[model samples]
Target: MQTITWQQFEQTDIRVGTIIEVTDFPEARKPAYKLMIDLGPLGIRKSSAQITSLYTKEELVGKQVLCVTNLGNKQIGKYISEVLVTGFEDGHQNIVLAQPASPVPNGSKLM
Candidate 1:
């Protein structure tokens, strides 16, 4: 794997956001969800996460998750993903969302 300097890593705008909406994305080749997150000062941003194996739509609402905000927008079929929902892969290859240990203000930057 390639290594990056700490300064370069800091350039990544990882922040906290609350999931306000979740919907199924059938258009995606892989199973995923369409999410609308409230990023406080950043406003609402949309994301597409392939976390269906470990998460349900009903359970995701109101959950605080880590987001990479400055990745720019990505087009997934007709859906426009505005932010990246950060996560790691589980042993079974399911996505495990990266989240704060405690509740933090939405849009709070990672330090």
Candidate 2:
């Protein structure tokens, strides 16, 4: 694996955000959800997450998730994802969202 400096790690703007809304994204090539996240001081941002294999829209609301907020926008079909909702792949290659072990203030930087 490639190694990175502390500065490089620090430069990554990873933060906590609450999932306020989730909706179906039929236009996406892969099954996914369009999410609206509340990042507190960072304001609300939109993202597209391919976590449908393990998550449902009803279960996603109010969930606090880690987001890479500075990656810039990603264009997927007609959607413009404003942030990157991070996660890990399970044994079945399904996504399991990255999250805090406990609740934290929104927009809190991962240090």
Candidate 3:
């Protein structure tokens, strides 16, 4: 594995955000959802998550999730993703969201 210095790791701003809205993204080549997330003091942000196989819109709403907030925007067709919703690929390659064991304040930085 490649080792990164503590400074390098700290430079990545991973924070918590709660999903506030969910919409279908038919324009994406892969099945995905357009999400509006509330990052507390950071305000609302948008993201595109391909976790449709394991999650539903109803389940995602109000769910606090980990996000990489400083990667900059990614353009997917016409949608601009402001943050990267973090997750891990399952054995089937389906994404399982990275989240806290219990609810934490939105925009809480990962330590």
- Candidate 2, residue 52: CA error in Å? 0.8
TM-score of 2: 0.98
- Residue 30, model 3: Cα distance from true site in angstroms: 0.4
Worst 10 residues of 1 by lDDT: 86-95
Best candidate (score: lDDT): 2
How far out, in Å, is residue 52 in model 3? 0.6
Q: What is the Cα root-mean-square deviation between model 3 and the actual structure?
A: 0.6
Collision pairs in model 2: none
Comparing 1 and 2 on TM-score, the stronger one: 2
Model 3 agreement with the true structure over 1-111: per-residue lDDT tens digits: 999999999999999999999999999999999999999999999999999999999999999999999999999999999999999999998999999999999999999
**Model 2 segments beyond 4 Å from truth?**
none
Model 2: per-residue Cα lDDT over 1-111, one tens digit each:
999999999989999999999999999999999999999999999999999999999999999999999999989998999999999999898999999999999999999
